[model samples]
Target: MLVTAFAANKTPPPSPTTTVNHPETRQIHLKPINRRRILTSLAATITPFFAPRLEVNYEESNLVTATFLPSADARGLFQMPPPRLSNRYFLVRAGESEYESMGIINTNPVAKTSMDNGLSKIGKIQTVKAALKLKEMGACDNNCWIWPSITQRAYQAAEIIAAINVVNRSNVVPEYSFLDARGLGAYEGRPLQSVSEIYASDVVSQNVKPPPISDGTPNESVADVFVRVTQLMSILETQYSEDTVIIVSPDSDNLTILQAGLVGLDLRRHSELYFEPGEVRYFDPSSIPKYKQPASALYKCLNPPSCT
Candidate 1:
């Protein structure tokens, strides 16, 4: 009964009959760089001029010289043991010049101790693996879902630029809309579909009887839904200069709620935007896990409790 009441009282869904018209183009202005000033300010052979100013401090260097010596049998006869061996031996030169003599030394237990404690090749590999895993996990923040769209657009633009490969262009034209959706129909003059209409018509129309009033509170208001749609549209526009057209059709009462919300957000006069409801996608927010804290926070709470 709740579902029926909500649906019946809801605003008429958006019209999906419309198709995308000619793509709109808006010019973004940018200030041209002053090449003359740049050339005048540029230094010719700047490195050469500053080369004398730079001083190399060879006197203060604390470089350590390591010399390898032949092991017993002198023909690679001994198997090199693991670094943990306290008395591990290696060949080294006894003195500084060509006059250096071959001598066996205990290798100063402290020196061997330092070399033993250094990261092993396996340890280095493990460190790299851990770093990569952390980076992958770090990308999944609250905005993770939005990244796919952003990345796709970026890749497409890159491809276009690479394909053209022209120089001295006055402006770079962007030729893709990232806000296109599958299914649903158009409202107003725009030719894109919305989620609400798709959900109501496809899902709600299936039941012969009206849905009962739900005991559970609605996850979001129609206006809230509209706002989210608009916000997503604005985000796309700001990021990629793409426009989003939303269409919703609701019953008179429910329409009032939607219109009020739209007016509150000052999007009522935007002709490119629409509100018709016959076709829209219905996303059930409840299906997704909603955590009080972000994924990072959750990780911190579990792994490094002190980080919080």
Candidate 2:
């Protein structure tokens, strides 16, 4: 009786059935992205990523700076270079170590390779001494490339030209690397007051593109953004033996991108570092450990739906 009751309560199997799929299904297409006129639009962030093989010195010259500063060389209220020029040549792609340094100072417009901001003579002497001292400490090695930010090529040319003079006068100095400033051909433009802002607005804040301007402003170009991020990453991933310094602009987007990459904030919220114009800042990779995920650098989640 119990067995019969259990069988009666059990579920029954139904007869065979046929299923059908729609013949006219819809296909989804993603709208095209307008790459140009976007602020801080790094190459990797946009389409057509960089070449697989990034030569260490594409437009770079060998350069050096110090790992640590001697009290005398570490002068200045904030130990900053003057308002315009980090003229010394330094390696673009360094390594991720405490001993390696990526110095960022400043760059300004120049009419020729031998010009500077002409803003400060005292600043030149101080930076010259500091850059050389860094070379001894194993930073740029005295042969570094003057950074060519869109707005500061001329300024960089002036600073490195000044540093080259110091390398010549000093008792022991590496020959200024890469004889030319790579032609300050692309330095004429309006300044980008906040490179960091562009990234934050577009990548982080989900904002509109800046209005296209033809005037001399640093109209964010895809190639230029790619160059800055790649050069800085090369320094972080492969080059350098210690903490690095950068003679950079107070508000450079390139510098901000470097800082963001280092801190592993791409997938969370965009992070940035703020330095006063001509202010000196020590960038230690140790401060922000590398991301555990090997591809975080490439993934660089700039616009995660939930990322800050």
Candidate 3:
């Protein structure tokens, strides 16, 4: 029976013409998965070897740091000292062209004390001092024909004159004619009365130089001096017509006018108006005699001043 069963199982082998399909022989297909997830997993498996550990300190440490120190002359509460008359000279010169084009006249009206005081207070501050320093440093020369300091001062003076003129025309202030001391001349091609004559005729003093008083004296405060100067400037304004522009030559004369506080002027107003000394090819370095050359590298190393 066993031999017969074996022979029967063997007889089940298929002939060459007959074929049977097997499930294992059929083609198989796979479903797609997220490529990003696979790549992330692969990267995570290899990253630990390439990364480095970093250490940070939480406690404060004493570290010596070297810093450059500026020289003693370079360090001061005021970058530059208060402006003197010399500074205004350049300011007026720079504004001359504009004054001519605008037909600004040098009108000399008597200025009230309050008006003078208001303007003088603005001039004493450090900002004005810094402006004066810049003025001293810029320009082609002390006599810069193009953008002189006197031009800038004249510009400021013109504005004040314009304002006062408007006030007078509107009848806000009494219309009063002071003497014109400018002498008869053509200013910017216009025939005008002299500034000197204006000062001489209407006002008791025509170009009368104020008597020199001792400096640093208690008899009159600097503020009082400013008031007097402003008054003179106002008087000058009243004497000239709106068509005439006062041309103050050279920066020194302009500064003298400013020092007198006659124009309701401030240096800061003209700081950017004119070329500075450094900008100028030539300037009077003697104007600021205190400024000196920096010490040599070796000298500075040997003689450092105390900072504290």
Instruction: Candidate 2: list runs displaced more than 4 Å.
Output: 1-203, 206-208, 216-218, 221-227, 231-251, 267-271, 280-283, 289-308
After TM-score superposition, the amount by which residue 114's alpha carbon in candidate 1 deviates from its true location, in angstroms, is 67
Of candidate 1, the 10-residue stretch with the lowest lDDT total is: 91-100
lDDT of 2 by residue, 1-308 (tens): 00111122344323232222334452222223445624445654643333232335535666542244434344432111113222222322111111111222222213222223222444444345444545555554443333323323224423553364343323222212111111111232323333444445444332223344343233343224334454544433333334333333313334544444444444223333443333333455456554443354433433321233
Highest-scoring model, TM-score: 2
lDDT by residue for model 1 over 169-219, one digit each (tens)? 223222222211211112211222333343343222211121222332222
Name the top lDDT candidate.
Answer: 2
TM-score of each: 0.15, 0.35, 0.19
| Residue 149 lDDT (model 3) | 17
RMSD of 1: 39.5
> What are the runs in model 1 whose C-alpha is more than 4 Å off?
1-219, 242-262, 265-308
Q: lDDT tens string, model 3, 1-308?
A: 00111222244323222233436543222223557867897899866544443233435546543333333324322111223222222232222222223433321222111222122223223223423443445431222222211223322333343232332322212212111112112221232233333223212312233232233112222233234334434443444333222222222222332332322222212111233211112223244223222364311211111000
Judge candidate 1 at residue 227 and give its lDDT.
39
Scored by lDDT, model 3 comes in at 0.28
Comparing 1 and 2 by lDDT, which wins?
2
